[model samples]
Target: MNQYSTHDTSGAQLKLWDSAGPFETGAMQQLRNVASLPFVFRHVAGMPDVHWGKGATVGSVIATKAAIVPAAVGVDIGCGMMAVRTSLTADQLPDSLSAIRAEIERAVPKGMESSQTANHVKGGWAITPNSVGRAWNDRFEARWRAILARHPKVDGKTSDQLGSMGGGNHFIEVCLDEEDRLWVMLHSGSRGTGNRIGTYFIDAAKEAIAKERLDFHLADKDLAFLSEGSQLFDDYIEAMHFAQDYAVANRELMMGRVLEALRKHLPAFKTDKQAINCHHNYATRERHFGEQVWVTRKGAVSARAGELGIIPGSMGTGSFIVEGLGNEQSFCSCSHGAGRVMSRGEAKRRITLEQHAEAMKGIEARVDEGVLDESPAAYKDIGAVMDAQQDLVVIRHRLRQIINIKG
Candidate 1:
């Protein structure tokens, strides 16, 4: 059975779903802060992957009546996972995947620091606003323009940031499922444009609160929020929606590029019948507990009945494709992945090159000191993370990486 701890305040009641053994103190503190908020609709739901994050815990589901926290959505707006089944099997792959990895590096712009950011940039935009961005921008440009007009501070360069990969923990991989079928997977978010948009709005929210001289126990400056019906709130919503679209397109564009890379080395292959891309860090309006509210899922994947989602493992571990169980108590959500057990800085300091190389021996991925922080040891056991939420999502596929490109 799922276990929880609850807290009550005059403003709201909060519930945190966590296993007794693995919950972190930092996560609990963030939960406490959210519970103290005045407009919180119901209890805060924490998933097994719970960890400390900027405004809210990473693996939390927070519902609010009429206000939205910009930082809670995070700088990587619409950050999520994407995976596609392929016709290729493990047996079809070459003995050494180095060629495949190099081909992918050539096809997709993987590492931004090494690649010419200048080529990827246009008019001070970070992502180059490729065809994908242009199409999506055109569809929402009218709304975007209107919002920016009202809030003139809402920079318009975010559109050019689409289709780019952001740094840290974001990655692209080629994997083989338990049954040996190939799967291409990646994780990224709205790039420079998204960061600028998020930062600008977060400051605006804080300024709005400061202007009113409101009094409240804010856990972190990142918790500053825009109240519903306010002009700033409207602008954030519109801007965030556009960022979400950009994020989705960003992954799609990367996936296309990765596939092209595979074609360069592997035999002619086709994508399988199924593919899934899901956002785990964003908010949307949903009906729950007989009321309509904005549900913010931070490092939590929606687990509504029959919903398909991706739960990635750390580098050198197994990843899963899952179907939601629609457990209402969890806000119909599941953990995004095996949560980090240590900060990247700490992980890099704690783990050794020998350990990382050994763990990644069979995989075609980078093993240099640069990627030590993302070593599998830095994250919770994927098996344990999945076992903790058997009731939340049903496993559809268990995948192991063969080739991984960390960004």
Candidate 2:
């Protein structure tokens, strides 16, 4: 039996798994807009955690033939999750989680007002650790310099930012899986350099559309796309791949930072088990339904059968490590995390500091008004989200966050 409900729009179709949580009118309309696009392949797939986003709805999986939409991919080019199961167990952790949180915040730069901010973190790894330098020199630096050769504006101090975590939904946490094993899980992306690439390409596509006067009756100008063979399209795909690689390396660098911090407080441990690093907000070429096409997962994760992905809950809740079932209909994808139920502004206005604090009473995380926007109440019920996508993935490890560090 099919696990999705089909919504027929003016063009193509939308297969949504709405049993976990219902989407708002705007979110549904966004999917319909993509469906109406001329290059969209087959149909659109909306995950259970579907919600509204900047250009396209979050939790959307779009497959296109001969064209790619940069806006659909969003700004956090390679944003995703990375997790590692440490040798330590829950009982081995310190009685107070605050020390761990403090050490992590100290080791990693985070919560900047914007990527351009000069004073985001006090005394950030100013000297650039020898290890981080080695990691970048090994692979990242050369790729970035090549991208800079073509697009100067996309360049940034990648050396300083490579291992850093940016603000918003990005975070680092120490969690305990169902088996009581300790784990280090973090969320980040390609950082500032990726942001510039994503923004540059998204606008470049729209600007090209405006310059050449090519309009396929686009409902929203942000839906602009570049044809597969176009020069701009080639440039974007190359740049995007660079950012994706940077993001992977970025997470690896941060995981190293976290492990170093933990080593100071606890017994020496190894993070060689159950390691997973997957990208949720990126696009790539994949074959589905007998045709090769570009697949963009906005707020989704690739869940090819047996492949592992991480789906995290809110600050107070927990997370999941799942192995994909490779559901072809959904293009082998699933939700990235608990989709936000309210916007940041709305969350700040509606949720009180007291309510946020109460919600995260046990978790070692920020409860100040500054972080009220990330309150658990601001997001959908994660349990319902998992239940809704049962056919897409099977839960491997359910991890409850014991130490949450927000950036």
Worst 10-residue lDDT window, candidate 1:
117-126
TM-score of each: 0.92, 0.95
lDDT of 2 by residue, 1-407 (tens): 55788855445588998855457989988999988898999889999889998778899999999999999998899999999998899888878989889888877888563322432342234567777889889987787788788889887657777788888889999999888999999999988778889999988999888877655688888998898889899999999998899899989989988899999999987777557999999999999999999999999999999999999988889999999999999999998988988999999999998999899888899889988888899999999889889999999999999888887
Query: lDDT (CA) for every model shown?
Result: 0.81, 0.87
lDDT of 2 at 334: 91
lDDT of 1 by residue, 111-221 (tens): 455444334433223454356556656665676677667766656555554555666788888988888999999998877656777889989988888777667767677
Name the best candidate (by TM-score).
Answer: 2
Candidate 1 similarity to native, TM-score: 0.92
Per lDDT, the best of the predicted structures is 2
Q: What is the C-alpha RMSD of each candidate to the true structure, in Å?
A: 2.9, 2.3
lDDT of model 2, residue 307: 98
